[model samples]
Target: MEEGRSSKGGVKKEYKGGITPFVVGVSIVAATGGLVFGYDNGIAGGVTSMDPFLRKFFRATYRKMHQEEARSSAYCKFNSQILTTFTSSLYIAGLIASMVASPLTRLYGRKPSILVGGLSVLVGAAINGGALNVGMLIAGRIMLGIGIGFADQAVPLYLSEMAPKQIRGALNMGFQLFVSVGGLSASLTNYGTDKIQNWGWRLSLALAAVPAGILTLGSLWLPETPNSLMETQGPEKARAMLQRIRGTLDVEEELSDMMEATKTSEMVKHPLYNMLQRKYRPQLVMAVAIPMFQQLTGINAIVFYAPVLFRTIGFQTNASLMSAVILGVVGLAATVVSMIAVDRYGRRLLFLQGGLQMFVCQVIVAIILATKFDSSGDGSISKGYAYLLLVMICIYVVGFAWSWGPLGWLVPSEIFSLEVRSIGQSIVVAVNLLFTFAIAQGFLAMLCHFKYGIFLFFAGWVFLMTLFVYLFLPETKNIGIEEMNSVWTEHWFWKRFVNQEFHIPIGIKTSSNT
Candidate 1:
């Protein structure tokens, strides 16, 4: 086995590169987008819980109703629709921006795309924090969505290109790790400001600006991805960038691989048209499926309706809020674990591991809630059942954070080429938000009507997610971004994943053109 150690698989066996501090630093700066992403995610749900902001912007129904809906059915339905719109506005805007993200990234390059995202969030946070009415809040939500769209689309693409195969999985997940951190920060800030009355939620949301501003300014000094420079600029600039980012003069071999890949990438006569050809169809399907399943896993349903779920399971208002904050902490911890172990353990293993655990967790949660969380005739779930439900939900969050949360972003970026990278990401990420929007808009109704049945729905999705990964997606652990077409187009590719013992023949020719 002159191919080195035949004893192992993935990035470890293929790459012997050491981690560079400069690359790590740049990654940290770019990943601040995840922080803002997470912060906004947590903050939006929590803001409605703050009495002062809710009363002011939402016109005191939250206060008058005592955290419950109005007695009038018509008014309640109208109010619920409006409130749902406010929360989903960001995601709606995200869908709009995602449609155009590919072309924008192509035009501006990844760095500028990220800069636009950061500035958009900065403006959004300012508007929401100072809003006097629901209209202003919705407007701010749109900007936030647009901003996050830019960051989410570009950050993963940038990391996948800049990072070596050895650290690619781990480095790409850095965004997810920081997202958990940002979420945790929002939870803590909410807890800290819980007693500050009306303006507390405003202050909590405004804090998202801090990270946005930091990423926007810090990214100015980051080196553009060599892949991007190679395709758009030229070899000399690409080589210089490789030297700076990798901290090496010995980049000749690496440069050769990228150059060859870039040539193959530009072989396309028409970008979108060529991307839809038979050879590219499989990656396109996977690109769409990964993000869609990530949302369909019902994690957002849990997040958007946490208080209602907690209260339904018998938690007091204070206890429910506290539970959300604790869940945020647990999720952040799990994401950190993913960042450390992703490259070491390989992507598919973690994905399969998480799927198994999440499936089981959902089953248990459904059983517990179904059997134990009966209302006490006063609309409160029994205390014992509430506590039991809490434990199960924590376990559920752990499973998601470790797997889909990080990998959802990482996978799409890896599976596409430079030619369609931006647009491909735009399509998938937009689909992700669309799934998110559907869940956000419909979840409360699901909660009111289905109760424990909602967890069961998630459990069913876990089964499909697990099977999809196992049967369809191959182990792309150490595969270079440029070599992806070869992997997808290999003969008997389905068997490669199924048998696990079969390796592609060394001299086999790729039939991507066929």
Candidate 2:
């Protein structure tokens, strides 16, 4: 028994290694894309105050009309749509651009692909900041979308590949953390400059370029992924990179294991084709389902329209922006909690707990709105119920941050094997971007048309998500990549409900043929 225990310890020692400084360095550099993603998403809300510049541009381009005529014109009402087009076109472009990530990552390697993404963002930011009209802004946003597409697809994958198995979830989730930070930064910047209308919005939009520049410069110093190095180069170069990354000279066994993993990954047939095949249908379902539910939770509606929602609940403009900042703070805090809890308590537990909490909060908010308990005369809302609505929004944000925000990215990368990971994750992100575009485009209209019914619609969806997660998601606490397929296929209930859960762990011995 002592000898058996000793053998187990030996095996564990082989699995464990020193921290990889290069990996840490590279992850920070790559995560700039996440910052760009967050900044672009959040900046538009604040930029809406640039009505003077927009009006000037509109007046300069078209025939002058009387003040009353301009006030009542269709362009006045649809000015927001023009801005939405500028902003949301990036997401649409991202959705289309993500389709290329699998091949791009394969051809260029993750690092170079990320560099190209950063450059695109920089160019987009410059164009957007210098835009003379809505058309130019839309063009810039399209370029930004291309950047986002590459970063969203590559950064998470790069993080997952470089991370140690034990801490992969936490490290991968760093993307979400940076996203929250970027959002918070944008909020604070906007709030600080709210009094200065001329340059505030442009500065807010351009600030995103700083991170992209830094990341682009920093990428030059980082090492490529060992897997990428091996696949593209040869064994010796791969071994050297592994040594530098792992800070260990004795990487013969580790190198062998990685080579075998890569070879097996290569032998697997066309991943995109396989993803659509029956054999991989379960994984494909999971990839699509998680992101679908993530967007359907209406987090974007709240984030994108927080100030509007707050004002609807009775807050003044200054107060509404302040409340939005508070909401962002709550979201950041909840994400920090998730970062700590995800690895400790595991992914499934958080999803179940967070989904249920979100459902309850949504129901409460919907009920309050539906009953007209807080409505003011003249189509305005009362301020008395602001605290109640704020509390509910905070609760919903917490629920989303702790579960869906990070896990939505983490799970898909883990669920698919390396063979199909690129395509699988791209599909997941594409669906996410698509739904994000759809929701962002239609959310205000839906709210305007359906009133409080929109909240109820989201509430119903949250409840459904809670049921799905409770019944289907699997526990993937400390599983290795090679074991994923067996774990997924063996458990009948897990296989059936895999779409509901984030990551389902499979236990398989690499040495066994079975």
Candidate 3:
């Protein structure tokens, strides 16, 4: 039962006992939290474009959508703030919930937070499916948002803590893989349900409960992570759980690391306030920056409005939804690729490559739109060019799904020391949901004004984020969660802010690298 511990040089021996059946099964179950998140993300865009959905809640927007407006105004057809509010409101609620869930997650174990989130989604789905008025709809959305915030805040941390050091990157990526799967499921549901006429949208919205329910029930049987047990229970219980999870009794070394981390965590009177110290500057910066950059990449803007975006670019109603389904498929496949390669190739390389790939795809899409559809041309794009646009969009989705989509959750979850890990993940979810709200709220409006230039706006952001990663982000591949500080301490720029002595107190031989 040899396991890799974080070393300065690199991982010594890979955990031969990593990827146990119990651990993999639990990781898969916990990853369903991402399914709820992705399903909701994919559902909003498709449902918004459904004729029945719009005619019921937003007749004016529906009327505008059907009218023979100017080609330039095509982007503005669905630009109603109130309509976008239905989608964006969830994110605003999620932002608040992520912040509120932080202390609760720390006080309790991660499993309770996940359970609460799932139940909220279940109730919210029921509300949404039965809603007859705008008020009911928004209220339901807020509940869903709360579910997402809590789930998003805790699941990554849960996965990170549960995963073995050698396979941590691959296991953490299970969250994003399920997210892509959930999005694809939503797209396929929307594509099929669109034909059911008046009540189809309800079915689409209601089906969110399936994943939520699974997560809720599955969480009941799941064991708390060894780290959580170490903190809340005791070292012996933590060791026992670790043995069970690892399928081995030779867990003394790993349990010792958890004990040391817990000791440091115990010293902190207030984890949130302690995060503001100079020693934690790098972790705090990453907690904020990574998720912030993830949203700014404009992936969510496209994902949340794919159906509307395709229709705006001249696809018919059915075609737009089908395009979204294709995007989801591509995203799901790319995530699988990421799961395989993240640990092998490392996060830094993928981040740079994915950023570059997305940047190129966006610029190409922008150029195609700029030249193909101008004032002189008819509002409609040529069928050939339309297919090309979809291809480019799919390529862009591939880049994002493989990179920022998963790593955004992964990096923040693994970076912080145990003392601030929960709070750090809360910040990650908060920043993610905040910008997600902004993008969902303003994307259509921005498209109305910036038109093709909006792609350029996102491309600019992609370039900056890629540069940020190249300069600041250290490779966290194969590192134990407790030894994360060593990665920062060895970095060129981050080392100045990281205090090795603070993270590894006197006589703690946690890492030979340090």
What residue pairs are clashing in model 1?
A: 52-198, 102-423
Q: Pick the candidate with the highest TM-score.
A: 3
TM-score of model 2 (CA atoms): 0.87
Superposed on all Cα atoms, the candidates' RMSDs to the truth, in angstroms, are 4.5, 5.1, 2.7
| Per-residue lDDT of model 1, residues 46-112, tens digit only | 6765667656766544644454444322112113556777778889788888767777777667898
lDDT tens digits by residue: candidate 2, 1-514: 1111021121221343667766667776766667777777776665553344445444431232223344232112223455456557888999988888778786567887788778888999898778877788788888889888888888888887777667778778888887887777777766776666566667767777976786677667666777678778878988887787667888776676567667766886677886776657767877888889999999887877676566555566567777778877888898889888888889999988898899889888888776644332323445656588888889999999889988888888776766677788799889999998988887756765666777788888888877877766666666544445545544556455334222322221222444
lDDT of 3 by residue, 221-295 (tens): 888998988888899889888888898888776777678788989999888899999999999999989999999
Runs with alpha carbons beyond 4 Å of true place in candidate 3: 1-17, 69-72, 374-378, 503-514
Please identify model 1 stretches exceeding 4 Å from their true place: 1-17, 59-79, 267-270, 375-378, 490-514
The best-first sequence of candidates by lDDT reads: 3, 1, 2
Instruction: Please tell me which model should have the higher lDDT, number 1 or number 2.
Output: 1
lDDT of each: 0.75, 0.71, 0.89
Q: Kindly indicate the candidate among 2 and 3 with the higher TM-score.
A: 3
Q: Give the best candidate by lDDT.
A: 3
Shift of residue 372 alpha carbon in model 3, Å: 0.2
Query: For each candidate, what TM-score against the reference?
Result: 0.89, 0.87, 0.96
